[model samples]
Target chain A: MQYIYAALLIYKSGKEITEDSVKAVLAAAGADVDDARVKALISALDGVDIEEAIAKAAFAAPAAAAPAAA
Target chain B: MQYIYAALLIYKSGKEITEDSVKAVLAAAGADVDDARVKALISALDGVDIEEAIAKAAFAAPAAAAPAAA
Candidate 1:
């Protein structure tokens, strides 16, 4: 019975979105606190651009399925 | 001005968790696919008790902070 929890992050003032910062946000959001999954997600984001990631995910999301029939 | 999309649903076998099967699993997981806010998160999960709403959202997601500084 695995469960998935989802969240959005807003960083403290001028800090760069680092793995550490991401970790901090996730911790603040209290998500998957016991596992290293949050850390992994943060690390996976390294060197990647944030706005770009958001755009990509946002776009890809719409392709998951067609609107249900009426 | 706002965006949040997260999803997980496994059904089509015995069908019961309605709101039209969680609006057909958020329109088959293309989530927020033009918003109705996934039909208000499946009618606020009507009549509640899906494992106690996943144990109160996995224990209020660990109390939203407290772990960072090591």
Candidate 2:
């Protein structure tokens, strides 16, 4: 959700989603950055329309599902 | 990210994460489905303990680091 939140931040702030910005966002939140995963996610998000993606996020998966199950 | 969410759903739902479950979660969220990526995520998480992963999630990779750099 943080990633989504960061993207949300980027969108809201009218900033572009890039490695540095994402890193900055995570750092602001005192979060650790995983180099490999970050790369993977960025790659995954290539060409993705953040606005549409975020809109779908709300309806996407259950937020509490994984933790509750485990 | 959706992959992680699906894993979380698996953990919370107390269900083992199979391809089908991930598909279900993605379907529910109304998110775009990526078969290759989903398979890759499931494979990547093979021996992972979800609790540890989630706990680490907050502390792990920056939720927004990737695309911003790309």
Candidate 3:
């Protein structure tokens, strides 16, 4: 979880999301940095659009299931 | 990023984190789900404490530094 947060921190800062960047953030935050998790996070985020993902999370909650009237 | 959000969606719903569950959430939201990315996300989050991650994110910003001790 912290691994992901590290990646988010890097992404939010408009910096390139990389293993080093994540590790730096984790180190700065005084959190235990797991190499395996960091590597996995960087791998998982490959090809993922961080901006799009943030946008999706922004409207994650779906509205009522009521039918719309024409 | 959406993959992370899908996992978060599952976590938020108190459901077990699984590729199928994450895919389901993405499908419900009408978003494209890359199977490889979903698989990687599930792998990355393995053994991770989602609750702790959420808590960390909540208090992500560090308090301002000040001299308090006399």
Candidate 4:
């Protein structure tokens, strides 16, 4: 969970989601950094459009879901 | 967010991702249930391969990213 948040935070901050950056974020958050997990996240995110995925997730976010006036 | 988590939980439990089911999960988790949000989640998840998305996310999960033994 924290790992995903770290990735999202990096993407939201307009920073590149490199292994070092992810580690830095996790370390800053006091999360025990795991090299393998960081690698997997980077690899999985490769060729993935963070902006688009995040946009889709954010679109589904309940906060953004305003009901239409009847 | 709780809303997404709720949807995922329902999917994991082998239940349908309907508005009512999502609301039930959220309510069970003591989250502030919002009808609009539930509707949005259901609509967004409609036709979406929840299993695939979750698998991708899980694959990237650091806990699951156990590195090959060196």
Candidate 5:
């Protein structure tokens, strides 16, 4: 089976930001430097469908089949 | 400023999958395990807006101010 690695790009106000902004923040925060990797990541972000990605990432609780007795 | 770390959860067919699936794949792949972190990540994914997140992540080429003469 294929494998995928994902992460969250959270903003300061608890809002989600674009991958670019996330990268910028990571750079500003002094994460390791890998120019090639950064470029690849940016390109991937550009190509990704964020909405779909989120949907895939989200978890929904299973509905109860029957109510509990009082 | 607060920092957010994000990753892409890729599927076998080159399609995006949910975080749980991604986590499962990763687990299957023998990546390091962190149950607490996984739980937090799943919860965060539940709260995110994928569409908005993608829009934020997308990059649009700046319209050219002027075309160069041939």
Candidate 6:
């Protein structure tokens, strides 16, 4: 949803993903900001590797799967 | 967000997180399923450590942050 997208946007911008930053992004997007959800997201993302998660998302197809040995 | 929740439910159930499973979960929840989004989520989570990711999410607080030296 917009909450996760907001976090991803902050991640992509190389800015620290804090509650305030996420709220700012959501606000700029004209999305109704939910404070509790934003807080939960920031907490849930604690110690998560945003770069790795995003990289995985970028590989959005079975073609990106590892090749089988011939 | 329901899509992500569906995937998480599959994950938590110790079942394989396939397109079918994800769709089933969403369907059971009476949520309108989006095929493309489910496909993308499966692809995105292909190499992700879901256990590790969930563990990180379990850490949901600033108090979970590393302690500052007194």
| Candidate 5 residue spans exceeding 4 A from truth | A1-70, B1-7, B10-20, B60-70
Deviation of model 4 at A50, angstroms: 1.3
| Candidate 6: tens digits of C-alpha lDDT, residues A1-70 | 9998888888888899998999999999999998999999999897788888877776643223323211
- Which sections of candidate 1 miss by over 4 Å? A1-8, A11-14, A67-70, B1-70
Model 5 over residues B1-70: C-alpha lDDT tens digits? 1112323323213333345544443443334546566666667667676557754434211111112111
Q: In terms of TM-score, how similar is model 2 to the real structure? A: 0.44
iRMSD, all candidates: 16.3, 11.1, 12.2, 19.3, 17.1, 19.7
RMSD of each: 17.0, 12.6, 14.2, 16.8, 17.4, 16.2
Quote the RMSD, in angstroms, for model 2: 12.6
DockQ (C-alpha based) per candidate is 0.04, 0.05, 0.06, 0.03, 0.07, 0.01
Q: For residues A1-70, could you state the per-residue lDDT of candidate 5 as single tens digits?
A: 0111222333223443445444443443334435566566656656666545544523222212112221
Scored by lDDT, model 6 comes in at 0.82
Residues forming the 10-long window of minimal summed lDDT in candidate 1 chain A:
A1-10
Q: Candidate 1, after superposition: displacement of residue B57 in Å?
A: 23
lDDT score for residue B24 of model 6: 91
Interface RMSD of 2: 11.1
| Better lDDT candidate (2, 4) | 4
TM-score of 6: 0.44
| Top-TM-score candidate index | 3
By lDDT: ranked, best first: 6, 4, 3, 2, 5, 1
TM per candidate:
0.33, 0.44, 0.45, 0.43, 0.31, 0.44
The CAPRI category of model 2 is: incorrect
Model 4, A1-70: lDDT tens per residue?
6778999899999999999999999999998766756765686689999777766555455433333221
Question: What's chain A's TM-score in each predicted model?
Answer: 0.45, 0.68, 0.72, 0.78, 0.42, 0.78
- Tens-place lDDT digits, model 1, residues A28-59: 33333434665566566567665676566444
Give the number of the best model, judged by lDDT: 6
What class would a CAPRI assessor give candidate 6's docking?
Answer: incorrect
lDDT tens readout by residue for model 2, A1-70: 5666776787699988787888889889988775555555666879888768765434212333454567
Which stretches of model 2 miss by more than 4 angstroms?
A: A57-70, B1-70
Worst 10 residues of 3 chain A by lDDT: A60-69
